[model samples]
Target: MPSNVEIKAALRDMRYLTQRAKELSGTDGTVIRQQDTFFKVPAGRLKLRDFQDGTGQLIFYERPDTEGPKLSNYSITPTNDPQGLVKVLTDALGQVGQVKKERRLYMVGQTRVHVDSVEGLGDFMELEVVMEEHQSREEGVTIANQLMLELGVKEEDLIDGAYMDLLLKNQQNAHAP
Candidate 1:
């Protein structure tokens, strides 16, 4: 498993690459909005992610939700492979409810910025700044900030809670309503 530091560095690099690609293609940096519904099965975790840009993909993540910040995820584009990977997981777990959210994704420097609002949850922002081979957190946070600005996100809009927490709270309100 890669340490958070290492993962952060790699993400920064990926951001840089993505930005360069956009420039080369003569396209302004783009944003992607998406909503993802996740289901957990006995075999693993399955997710159906829908991008507002008219694209969707299914992902299967097998990592145990152990206590920690480390999360491992792998995705398979259903458009390319369709039934192969998705069927293996869906056949095992059963369907979990659809999680809905709108996410704005942007690239800045060497990082990826994700500003999101989840239905029944609230507003949240995530910065995935990839580091270079020997970059530090300070460098990564700087890059993250750049991307945040590109997306017009404010630090105050950042929420520390997870989606499930917000969902449960919303559920309670619905019950009372």
Candidate 2:
């Protein structure tokens, strides 16, 4: 399985981060609209990510739910029939939740900087440090930390778990009596 060092954080200012990312990456970046439907799984996480186009990806990933940069092992398979696949997976594994977001992707060196506006969860940022075959986890962590500094991501702003988890938590809190 391929792996990368990743960090997710709640963002206070999107414009500031966008400007900084453009300055560092020397590109405008790509905007993507995505809807991810998570399924119930035993060990890892499984989500079908629809790109809002005709394309989608079935992704399975495992990572520790930690505040700092952590290693994520994942596999992705592309699909053209996302709706059909979603129905099948929902019938088979049962759907847990879904996350909808508009994401702007920027590349800084080997790191993917994601500035996202989730449907019900507000704004957030994610840093995914793509590791080379010979790279060590320490090296990936070092790179992620450096990028966090450059991107003005504070330690307090760091988040644990995925947007789906956050959305689910918010739902639970809303329904709590």
Best model per TM-score: 2
CA lDDT for candidate 1: 0.50
> lDDT of all predictions, in order shown?
0.50, 0.94
Candidate 2 ranges beyond 4 A from true positions = none
Span of 10 residues, lowest total lDDT, candidate 2: 17-26
lDDT of 2 by residue, 42-84 (tens): 9999999999898899999999999999999999999999889
Q: In candidate 2, how many Å is residue 151 off?
A: 0.8
Q: What does candidate 1 score on TM?
A: 0.51
For residue 86, what is the lDDT in candidate 1? 40
Find the number of clashing residue pairs for candidate 1.
8
TM-scores for the candidates: 0.51, 0.99
Per-residue lDDT of model 1, residues 1-177, tens digit only: 121211111122334444543553345545565566666666655677766445568766544343212233354655443334345555776555556766555554555544455676555555555556576556655655554455444444444334544576677788994
Give the residue spans of candidate 1 off by over 4 A: 1-29, 42-45, 52-54, 60-91, 131-161, 172-177
